[model samples]
Target: MRLSRYFLPVLKETPAEAQIVSHRYMLRAGMIKQASAGIYSWLPLGFKVLRKLENIVHEEQVRAGHIPMLMPTLQSADLWRESGRYDGYGEEMLRMQDRHGRDMLFSPTAEEMFTDVFRSHVKSYKDLPLTLYQIQWKFRDEIRPRFGVMRGREFLMKDGYNFDQSKEDALHAYNRHLVSYLRTYERMGLQAIPMRADSGPIGGDYTHEFLVLAETGESEVFYDSEITDLKFGDREIDFDSVEQCQAVLEEFTSRYARTDETHDEAVFNALPEERRRVARGIEVGQIFYFGTQYSEALGATVQTPDGTSVPVHMGSHGIGVSRLLGAIIEASHDDKGIIWPEGVTPFHCGIVNLKQGDEAADGACEALYGSLTALGLEPLYDDRNERAGGKFATMDLIGLPWRITVGPRGLKNGVVELTCRRTGESEELPPEQAVAKVAEIYAGI
Candidate 1:
């Protein structure tokens, strides 16, 4: 992508409404524009990153044996009524009437709709272990929606539902989701701790919210500091093996961790003084083992071996797909701008033509860009006729993981400057070596 042709309308000054670093940077970077209070239109760069996050969620969910499907943004109010939650869900749910005067809602969640789908076609225990998910836009009318995408009224999310014939099987599905979520967040360069959390309106006795600790987070959390030391890394696991999934669940959750809503002071106090810590957390995902709550309400039952109809054990898991961008920025950015992790960066690296019209510099940048792109990598080339400082500032603001600076001075010495965004470190190497180094850095991710 060439900067001269790109539609990045980066701002020179931060908007007064942006109260946090992510919000300010997102606005200044022109990734999103406010459409209304608490609503936004994702610009090209923002949409690219959003799609990247969505793809990662899909890969991890499918890797864990879950099927992908799409559901409508608007749903009949009858489903919520049947589940006895239409009136109970409160104002956050956008309830309205269609042209026919039928009650409708912009779905805040799809629990009731998914239950209706299950009861309509799935009738036997043979299909009991099925897990289905969708990445879709959801709306919850927040009275005071702030913090950009972090607490927006409309956002993208990946929500999955699991149906099982027995309680034990349902619990295994829950464990599988936990393992998958750990991988998903890790791939996005985040360490989201799974903390015991209150289920709230979702209504579940067992639930865990994956939170990334940031000072700007909304949730107050108490946890064992040692939990931060754990990493999913490259370990292999059989998602279908119940014991293997259960073992991971225990390994990650054995420590003391809970949000303030479910915090047990006694249990927290029992931890070694050095290990106990309190902080704020931004919730990125959650898993719930709600058993028969929705199934019983919606008559989503299956016939067992005994020829008896029974409500299926069920659970819902979710990842805040769009909000993750904010969380990542909050956790990873420095004072300059967002430092996108290689796994989710919009472009693999950037090409800066320090002397835009100079023949040697232009040729070097063009060659480097071609080399990176031919290797199946994306490079953002700042080919605009602009000052060196302005081009460098834009590259830093957009925060590509790596940048290659081509100039007549460097080319005369048979070298180009390759810089790391996160470390603010640079190395002078031949043009091919700069391209090779960037490719090598991103190969594993």
Candidate 2:
């Protein structure tokens, strides 16, 4: 993509309403624009990153044996009524009536709708261990929606529901989700700690919220500092093996961690003083093992081997797909701008033509751009006829992982400047070597 042809309307000044770093940067970078008080229109760059995050979630979910499907943004109020939550869900759910006077809603969550789907077609224990998910837009009318996408009125989310024959199977599904979520966040260059959290409206005794610790986070959290040291790394796990999944769940959750809603001072005090820590956290995902809460209410029962019927054990897992953009920026950005991780960056690297019209410089940048693109990588070339300072500033503001600076001076010496956006470090290398290095850096990711 060439900067001259792109539609990035970056701002020279931050919007006064953007209170946090992510929100401010997002506005200044022209990643999103406010459509309403708490709603936004994702610009091209923001949409690209959002899609990248969505794809990662899909890949991890599929790797864990979950099926993907689509669900509507609007749903009938009848399903919520059957689950006895039509009135109980409160104002956050956007309830209304259609032309025929049937009560409908812009779904804040899909527990009731998914249960309705389960009961409609699934009727036997043989097909009990099914997990289905969708990446869709959800609306929750926040009373005071702020913080850009972090607490928006409408957001994108990946919510999955698991149906099982027994409590044990349902719990295993919960663990599988935990493992997959860990991978998903890590791939996006975030360490989202799985903390014991209160399942407010979802109604579950067993739940964990994955949070990325940031000073601007909404949730106050207490934890043992050791929990921050855990990482899933590249270890292999059989998602179908209960023991394997259970082991990972224990490994990651054994430490003391809880959100403010579920915090116990006594339990926290038991930890070593050195390990005790308190901080703020941005919630990026959650998993709930609600058992028969939805199934029983909706009559989503399956016939057992002996011909008896029982409500299927069930759970719902979710990742805040759009909010993750804010969380990643909050956790990864520096004073200058967002430092996108290679795995989720809109472009793999950037090409800066320091002397845009200079023949040698222009030729070098064009060659580098072609080389990177041919290697299955995306490069954003700043080919605009602008000053070197302005071009460099734009590259830094957009925060591509790597940048290749081509200039007549560097080309005369048979080298180009390859710089790391995160480290502020640069290396002088031949044009081909710069491209090769960028490719090598993202190969593993």
Candidate 3:
């Protein structure tokens, strides 16, 4: 996209309301706009990143054998009542009534609604292993919604529900989700530790919250420092094999890790002092194995092979799709601005014409942009008639993973400056070489 035609309303001064790095940078970088006290309108750049995250989630989920479908933002209160949570869900739920005075709600979660769908059509054990998910908007009316998208009242989330015939099957589904989530977060350049965590209103005895450690995180966390050394690198796996999935679950969760809500001082003290670490964590996702909690409550039963009706075993998995933006920024940004990972950057590379109107400089940038675009990559060309410093500052602020600097001086030497945002390193390469390097960097991703 050309900077001159883009609708990025960057701020010269940070908003006073932004209290953290992610919030301040998001505001000053023109990623989001506050539509209300606890709500926001995602600007083009922000929306692009959000969609990228959603796509990664969808791809990983499908690879793990889960199907995707969408659900509504608003649902009937009757479903919540059927699940026995209508009154128990408390003020975070936005309860309302329609024109006919039928009670309704802006759903904070879709447990009850998903269960309703299950009971209505899925009546046999043959469909027991089905897992369905949706990426949609959700609302939870927090009394003090701060930290931009991190703790906003309205957010985007990917929530999946699994239905199974037995406890063992349900547990396997849980493990599958854990494996998929590990891949999902790693693809976004995050290391989300799966820590034993309390299941808050969801009512599950078994649950794990994936957290990215950041000083600005809200949840106080304790962990074995060795856990931080763990990485889910690129590995082949059969998602359908219970043993494989279970092995991964054990590998990632064997370390001592827990949030403040479930911290046990005695257990933590047993770990070697050198291996113990305490810090703050931003929750990016969670998985729950609740057995029959929602199914029994909502009468989502299936017929067994022996002709008996039984409540299906179930679990729910979720990724905070929008909040992930804040978590990624908190974990990856430097003092200057966000350093977006290549996998989720809005633009793959940026083209800066150090001398915008100069014929040679402009021609070089246009050529580089075309070369990158032809390779199925998007490059932001700062074609605006602006000073070199201003253009470079904007490129840094928006945080593209790669940048190509074009100038008459560089062109005369048959070279262009290619810079990496994460490392303040640059290399002088020919225009084609710069484009080829960027393409190869993202090829595996």
Query: What tens digits encode model 2's per-residue C-alpha lDDT throughout 108-225?
Result: 9998888888899999999869999999999999999999999999999999999999999999999999999999999999999999999989988689999999999999999999
What is candidate 1's local distance difference test score? 0.94
Error of 2 at 63 (Å): 0.3
Q: TM-scores, in order shown?
A: 0.99, 0.99, 0.99
- For candidate 1, the clash count comes to 0
Estimate the TM-score for candidate 3.
0.99
Q: How many clashes in candidate 2?
A: 0
**Residue 365 displacement in candidate 2 (angstroms):** 0.6
Off by over 4 Å in 1: none
What's model 3's overall lDDT? 0.94
lDDT of 2 at 87: 93
TM-score of 2: 0.99
lDDT of 1 at 209: 99
CA lDDT of each candidate?
Answer: 0.94, 0.94, 0.94
The positional error of residue 166 in candidate 1, measured at the CA in angstroms, is 0.7
